[model samples]
Target: MLPKKVKKRASLLAITLLVTVIGIFFILKSLNKNILYFKSPTDIKNNQNINFDKKIRVGGMVKKDSLIIKEEEIKFIITDFNNEINISFSGTVPNLFSEEKGVVAEGKLQDKTFFIADRILAKHDENYMPPELKDIMKKNAK
Candidate 1:
């Protein structure tokens, strides 16, 4: 038979462990739902069975000369230096979006080669300059 104090301590320990485990489980579950995986065009091409139902992010450079702006829609291609995927967005894009710049588009893939973007994110470094501006700078410097 265990002493009353010992029995109380054991119960407390067990409750603490159970609570901690439940907390961890809930945290992990929430994180799993919120996490959006980033993939490249090549990855999508290689993995044909990737989940298309869940929202995802695709990151790569915008392919040059692949942008077409219509009255209400914009279409472009994202490339990972190996493969390219066509992306279409019907809303306004970020001001920094341009060809040859790094971009991350969040949405679901319509098919293996096409993506419908819900959001478009353009990322650049602190010292980043647009390619056209950079070219002009180089010519001026020369």
Candidate 2:
């Protein structure tokens, strides 16, 4: 026969474990709302029904000859080889932003595959040479 104290301690331990597990579950559920996902234009094109309320990052190359600036609003098309998505933003663009460059826009998609960007991030390659140009230079050097 087990002692009374031992049985009480075992029960208390079990309850504590259950409470800890439930606390962890709620913590993880809340944290999930803070996590944003990144996708490409092709991914967005394939999954057109994604929830628009949530924030996300979209990465792609700025399509050539697609940039249009009108007063405060700037519009461009981002392409991921397989698909292109039009983006519009009314804010100061990054200094490095230009046509045919790789960019990641943080925003949400609106109607008709239009991305309303809240922020635009443009990346520059090291050595002052763009990645595409660097690749060409490397091939020629070899």
Candidate 3:
């Protein structure tokens, strides 16, 4: 038989562990809903099923000479060299956003080829390139 103090301590420890676990579970649940997956243009092209209603982030280098800035819209093509996805964004352009630069567009796909971006994120520095994007560029360079 366990002593009274020991039993009380055990119950307190169990409650602490349960509370911690419940806290973690809720945190993960919240994150799962808000998580945005990053995909390259090649990944998008190869996948046949994509949810148009869900927002996703697409990362790639902007295709050279493919940017067109109109009065109301900005259109560009992002390419991993193997495939390309056209992006249409209506928002303030980031200073780092330019042709031949790394950019990530967050939006829903109107179709497989066309993406309507609600937000555009550009690299903060010149040396910043996503590891996946770097690998894709290196594989295509050879």
Candidate 4:
């Protein structure tokens, strides 16, 4: 019973709504699969609501005197001053994976603060000083 102009407008609005709904659905689907949560040692220790099976990224300073490199597996401790988490990785480590450096481990948490890492990333400061050393220096300066 509507006029031609009103009918056309209704059709266009329906198509627009359908396209918007489909776009939103796909966007949410992709985000659910690709999103990863980042956690610090303190966060994991203080928060008990974290899911153990979810893949996550943990970042902190590699503990000095805690690195043990075997033929294939490497074990170390990551600390965020307030807490420390033990990590184990069985693969090639970055060239900068050494004592006193900033490292990020990607894996899933096993126990409360234990992470079974599948990949490890190491980063250094601008002066090539290890991140661990930089952290110590900053603390001393303060």
Candidate 5:
């Protein structure tokens, strides 16, 4: 038979191990909930079995001349060169948000082509211009 002290130590160790596992499990589960996967319009177009119910982030450049402002909602198209996804946002957009700017919208996909945005994240830099815009300007300069 194991000594009394050894038995107590083993039981304590087992309890500690179990508690550690449970803690890790809860930590990972919570992290999973907080993780928002980013997808482009092309990715959505290629994935036919996407879960529309889950919240996700869609990143792309705003399509030119696509912004439609209304009293209740703002609508626009996000494009990834090959595909475009329409988005409807019912909140105030950032001041830097405009056509041809990079944007990432967090929302639930209503359908393959439509996204209802809960948040709009416009790409901004200290210089007030992203590299993409610089390239456009360079091209226009040529």
Candidate 6:
């Protein structure tokens, strides 16, 4: 038979370990819910399971001639050559945003073909220079 003091200490240690494990589980679950993963148009097409409620980012090149603006809202398509997803946004986009440019739209997926974006992020290459900077450089050269 184990001594009473040793038995008490062992039970306490077991309880502490269980509590720590449960706390860790909750933290990991919360992180899993909050983390937003970037997916390409082709990934969205090939993946069979997609969480519609969770916000996700779809990144790809803007399909040429797929941009449509109406008042404050804009609609465009993102394609990865193999597949494409339609993105709809209702806010002002960055000046760098245009057709045939790389873009990442953060929002929720309404379906396999349609996505409703809360934000649009335009991507530019390292060589990209802002218009103001370009003008300044040209003036300096003159």
What TM-score does candidate 2 reach? Answer: 0.61
Off by over 4 Å in 2: 1-37, 126-142
TM-score each candidate: 0.66, 0.61, 0.62, 0.62, 0.63, 0.64
Better of 2 and 4 by TM-score: 4
For candidate 5, write residues 26-64 as lDDT tens digits: 998889735645788888888878887898999899999
Q: Rate the local accuracy (lDDT) of all candidates.
A: 0.88, 0.85, 0.90, 0.87, 0.90, 0.91
Expressed as tens digits, the lDDT of each residue in 13-127 for candidate 6 is: 9999999999999998889734645788878888889989988999889999999999988999999888999999999899889998889999999999999999999988678
| Residue range 98-134, candidate 1, lDDT tens digits | 9988899999888989999989999775696689998
Provide C-alpha RMSD values for all models, in order.
Answer: 6.9, 7.0, 7.3, 7.6, 7.2, 8.1
- Candidate 4 Cα misplacement greater than 4 A, ranges: 1-37, 128-142
Residue 2, model 6: Cα distance from true site in angstroms: 54
Model 3 error, position 71 (Å): 0.3
Return the TM-score for candidate 5, rounded to 2 decimals: 0.63
lDDT of 3 by residue, 1-142 (tens): 9999999999999999999999999998889735645688888888788898998999899999999999999999999889999999998978889999889999999999999999999955447677999899999999
Q: Least accurate stretch of 10 residues (summed lDDT) in model 6?
A: 32-41
- Stretches of candidate 3 off by over 4 Å are 1-37, 124-142
Compute the lDDT of residue 115 as modeled in candidate 2. Answer: 90
Residue clash pairs of candidate 5: none
For candidate 4, write residues 21-134 as lDDT tens digits.
Answer: 999999988896345345789877887588888888898899989999898889999998789999999988889788888899999999977899998888666676678997
Best of the two (1, 6) by lDDT: 6
Give me the candidate number with maximum TM-score: 1
